[model samples]
Target: MRTTKLIWTIVGAVTVVLLLAGVGIVAALRGGDDEPDPQAAPGPGAASALPAPPSATSPAPSPGADITGPLDLLVIGVDTRVSIPDWQPHADAIMVMHINEDLKSGYIYSLPRDLRVDVPAFDANGYGGGRRKLTEAMSSGAKVRGTDKADVAQGYELLAKTISDYTGVDGFDAGAILTFDGLSRLTDALGGVTLKIDQKVVSQHRRPDGTARKLRPGGGGYTGPQATYLPGTRTLTGWQAIDYARQRYTAGGDYTRQRHQRQLVRALLTKAMGAGLPADLTRAEAVLTALGDTLVVSGDRNAIEYAYALRDLDPSRLTLVGLPGDSVINNGRYIGEQLTPVGRGFLKAAAAGTPEAYLADHPKLINK
Candidate 1:
């Protein structure tokens, strides 16, 4: 009887252990499948520390074979006054980057910010609201629908939805909304990219006389702040490059400025991949670390795939095409306003994975 009792006790103990193990396994699976409960409220440091929240409306990741192929990314630069008090918050910068599966070739279609479109807003029912200025969706929504704060993430989502409505491109996700300051960190990470300012562009700095100090032209080796000022085909430091990209007060206004920004991007990509820089992994790590906090990205998988896809694109293959000159209305009110029809064509071309027609129609500005 004693032996039988002991046998039963051992069996009971084994069952308990197995039950606990099963419970743990079930918990792990549930955690993996479930999204974080939005009602759970983030901790004190969570707001600033966390990356932009994942798109609630984003589609599920594609299967392995479908992951590769042509991918379109809508990269939006949000100009929030609260974020940058010096500049007005506008959706002035828009680029649709198309990356092919082979990663050997890619194209960037830079859209004019003022191109009037039926700006889509996010309604309470999770649908889109009617049109307005492309830039106003975020600022206005933050004022009305949101808590009157600069919510860039929501703004991005609205833009993505609007683009989707205009262009029938399904699956093209809004990858990221990088602020202007983020450019500084990105350039720094690449160990300061080189850009040739092809014109005599003047940049004013703060002078001791309560005035601004101007930077004169010529090919000069520039890094950091000074690098940002040099114009017309010359090496520039990270900050300088960003400043060069941000300058819209040039003779051609925002249109010219957009061209310059695209040029700088091409130059930077060329420098980073060229044999000119030393193979210092430490510096690269530092640059990425500095940019880690400032840079905003969408899905991690998407970013990783894009990096791989763009690995083989040569500088020559990189076609930087601004919107057509005819599409722009240089009125006294808005210097670089984009016409809706032309803007629609540009977006459609971008969505269709071909922008050569648009580029062919637009004349390249002589690098000043």
Candidate 2:
């Protein structure tokens, strides 16, 4: 009984971690661009790609093709550090949130950052296609000729195309870029997010004070007493949440980190919805204000419209999916990740707007 319980607990933790990478952001920014902030600087890699103001004339072509119903949104979490210029950022976490036609039920899953895929040719960023790790698509697409600055929006465009091709979807209805800095601010605005941990994780990146852990003299890993998170329910501050989400050195490595990230998403969404934040004008405004710094969104509808459309979406109804896969090591060289046949089939069902039907048969794929 004990062994069975532990196995299920781990499975549940992994399953719930990746849901709502975008939902939480959508819920938190429900107020949208009603009042723009001129003083707030755009997030790193956030440039002119932001949506233009509403116009009296016909709208231009959307950055991505719009889906009328059963939309798929590519949500990317980037480790965008502004401290270094000319540093092209990679998509640390890539997720697709599929909202069924009814908008009541949804499925969320992550594409391994190191997954091997053939990135399509994107002329906008001068990326001539080739097979590479999935994360490189964003780094290659974000580059601008004769400029050191990276365009995160362009990166997202290429990534969306890559994912669309990979999943056999026409195109994404919308997309969002979540930066580490923005996530922290959003969490703080919500007073802090509470999450359940099924296993103990020690931070290898940050100290207990949220500062960088020192490297050993020759440098293979950090040399210090690490910040430890024990198994239990814990409320994490903005930095703590981000730090926890960034941990990939645990037993499950990146997969474990992925689980924690989705868990963070679930926690954020729960806090945003249940805390009377929408009704509290002051807190709502604060959450919205923090959003400007948190997300770079692109879709036919603005942030407000997306939020409103999903307003009635029940967080409980969303399904957290775990795609099965294994690392690809070629000639003893660790290359990337690849989904098994079953995982690929699951993505097809998800793209076709029938994941629940598919999950009905393959119960193991459902994270819960």
Candidate 3:
């Protein structure tokens, strides 16, 4: 009897061990099936052992028409002020951006703020007739019409009509204008850009208490105010780079400022396509959102296609042209001188994508 009992006890122990082993195997299998492989889902927080699916859609790239045709973009920058009612938002900058679809080259035609032109009436006979600064079109419309929104829209329309009338670019549509605001946001989106400062520039900021806050100069010059100086070719944070671009009061004044703005844009493009920078999906999303608000992209598919074709463009091929200096006339009164006939011709060529022909016709305005 004792031997039989001992044998049964041993058998029971063996059964228990087998049961545990079976349970362990089942658990292992379930865990394997439940946990997804980290390598398979590499998205945000995936590196931290968290499983996340990558975003399905990327931001729509700039649009274009033919991959090898000439494209023109009208870029407008508005300067907003709190005071002066609704008409205070005026276009401080205007640029005709031309892209060579085939060569992947680009150029910016900067229109002078003081360029004189026939100011179109936004409303019916609000002002009988007048010639004024090109920049005043928006403000005049807003102030005179007493409807800021309508005036702003009319302002853009007038500008488009003027370009079309002068250049004869058949499709110079009013809807092609692209506008943006808040330089800080733009700079932040680009991570940081490199800028080459040809000369030393200093800008002073005024404090609320009437004290002057002077930014100290730094070596290599400075990309932004933090460094206080950005010299030749160096990398700069977004804010710093924006400051450089917006430095209008520098010794070189508006001309230098416009050139810097172009340079800053090129730098941003370079960094965007470069290596070493982390793939910042969040920042990219923010940028897209901001652009949506700031840019008034035309609905034209051709314009969209042209933007896409510029993806592989070389920055060096991009040229910058200031409005002809001689075309500017200060009458010492309200009326400003008109854009030079050569300058107007350049605009015509740019709009038509025949810059070479335009240059041949007006050699004097071409940058040597």
lDDT of 3 at 178: 22
lDDT of 3 by residue, 1-368 (tens): 00000000011111111111121122223334445555457756447666466546653332232344454545555565544555344666666556675646767667666667676554541744367676776566545353444345545555554544444554432132222224545555555566777777664443323234554476333233332444677776545665566667776577667676666655555555462122333444454554344433223332224324444556566676666644443465444445566777777667566787776666655432
* Cα lDDT listed for each candidate: 0.49, 0.69, 0.49
- Assess every candidate by TM-score: 0.63, 0.79, 0.62
Worst 10 residues of 1 by lDDT: 1-10
Candidate 1 vs candidate 2, lDDT winner: 2
RMSD of 2: 13.0
Q: What's model 2's lDDT at 43? A: 55
Cα lDDT tens digits, model 1, 152-209, are 5555556665555655556453254555556655565555666666565554332322
- 175 Cα displacement, candidate 3 (Å): 6.7
Over the full model, what C-alpha lDDT does candidate 2 score relative to the true structure?
0.69
lDDT of 2 by residue, 299-331 (tens): 334544454455555667767777878999999
Best by lDDT: 2
Candidate 2 contains a number of clashing pairs equal to 3
List the candidate 2 regions with Cα displacement exceeding 4 Å: 1-68, 291-299
